[model samples]
Target: MMMVFCENSFLSYFPNGHIFQPSDASGVLLFIMTGKVLLNVFLLCVRRQNLHQSFMGYFCISLALLDLVLLVTMSFISHFQNFMLLGIRFTKYHTCLLAQITAFTYGILHYPVFFVAGLDYYFTFTQPLNSAAVCRRWLYTATVAFTWISALCYVLSLPGSAIGLDVNHYNSAYNCPFYISSQTYWFSLGMLMIMCLILILCWSEIVDTVQSVKVITYESETVLFFPYDPECSPRDCAKHLLARLLICFISTWVPFVLLQMLIVLLGAQIPAFIEMNVPWLYFVNSFLIAITYWMRRRHLKVTEETLEADPFVSWKFCLVPFRCQYIDKAQKSTSKIVMC
Candidate 1:
């Protein structure tokens, strides 16, 4: 005799003849697929040397991988019957704990990745000359390490007493094996709020800079370059590139953050329709990232490539908005000294 628990229309079915319907697992499934696609794109980027080519690309790859780790681990626990059975029954405590830690760590890392990326763009646009220090390889490596270490330390410090399996405890609920503490809940929400604030500030400055630039065509190219004022071209292009990056970041995260905050603060149950959709929203960053790269590739195809001598190869990619083909020539001119 299977006992089914119904929470609204969502049901859960247990192996022990205790069946309940919870919200559909489609959201988690969607996340899994999104992660897979993102991973493929990430691998492609690696093969194409895109990730190694720019600091921004490296950060993007790190973010994508972290996102995939979180989604795949969460999905595995949700869909693998044996794993779910063990987790729900508390049969394998250590294994379950490891999974919990892995998921939480990856989820927490999301905020720091955004925090660093936002800072990178903010400084790269607002402080052009000084931004060179910010984009240094050592610094980028340190930032990535800091993100993972901080998240690990924070998760490890949470009280283990509050961590346990709550299997179908509610009349209408999914039997999630990992029970996080209220402290964890508050910490996660706080992180999201902080990240949102940082992005808002960063993008505001970027938009302001972009608006200040008087865009004009140079040599038949709709370049942001101020040919008469060569000093301004690099900065203009920086602003334009950062503006697009900001848009991509915000579009993919704001809705997901709002929904998460609502669910956390109000105890409002997610609507079935939304529950099936929000998980995909979380992974939309990956798609936007790929689209950003594809757009760049398309732009390259449309425009003829011009080679120039620059001490830094990454600078070429960094000046993504303006074709920057003649930037070095402009920099060498007596009128201005432009250094990227």
Candidate 2:
């Protein structure tokens, strides 16, 4: 009687208890719709030659698509399942498979893409000479395709079987439609750790590039390598933008990933309520990616345009938004001192 009562209490908060709350459902739908529109706008604005920018654009678009599909699947499943019927199962075998798979794919696929984005930023600064080749359309396309393919293959290969849902089994509730056995749990955690390490490495390289300055002097040749200001480095200017991106990624994923890790360590002893709602955190990434990237695009465009006008501009450094600082002196020292 106590177990049944506890289960009923938990279910009441969820949409009809088995799905999502009405407010949660509305928010998810809004996120999906807004993401689709913003991602399209982002893609249209991407320059053909910006390989890193192009890669990020395609990755976000894929995320938006995945979110849209997942939303549709959840809505469809909610409609088909009659939660009020006490004797009937709330989630069918096939329905559970579809929902879990869609959610899993959306969450797991981002690990590789994030590593790629971090690498993109790192390499774009480190290899100034190779900027043209780095931004090549073909390379961006290939990298995006490879990452998605690998993530899909890994998720499909995980060991799991569809088991009937039973409230009496706390572990069973955690596994639900498709059972995520220990092997699968560890494998997914391992993948996320690997990507996180790669991101750290990328950031390390970025810091190195920001601290070092290469001086080039030649007669009848002009070049601007980095900001003339001592206090500001390329990385410093970009840190806020990159920080927001990283924060969005961590906030959206850390909760769910941490829960998965805890489950692996503690077995079924982890709190049922924490485990049940954690996956929803993954969906938060979709909305965050959309808003963060949308906000980033305007600043990126201004930086790129400024860089284009100054061939002397160092590829390794971001253009600081201090052009206005030099505006008053432009006429007196325009030729001698180029805008940093």
Per-prediction TM-score: 0.37, 0.38
The lDDT values for all models are: 0.41, 0.40
**TM-score (C-alpha, index-matched) for candidate 2:** 0.38
Worst 10 residues of 2 by lDDT: 270-279
List model 1 lDDT by residue over 97-161, tens digit each: 44344444544444355445444433333333333544666776776677668877875555432
lDDT of 2 by residue, 1-340 (tens): 1112132332222221132212333234345444544554453343223223435555645555555565565565456643524464453332434444443444454445555655554344333234465456667778867876775566455444222344334324433321222333444466467446535745754444445423232222222333234355665545433433343344335665575567566654311112212122223223233333434444443345323321222222333433434433433342432221
The CA lDDT at 239 in model 2 is 47
| Prediction 1 TM-score vs. true | 0.37
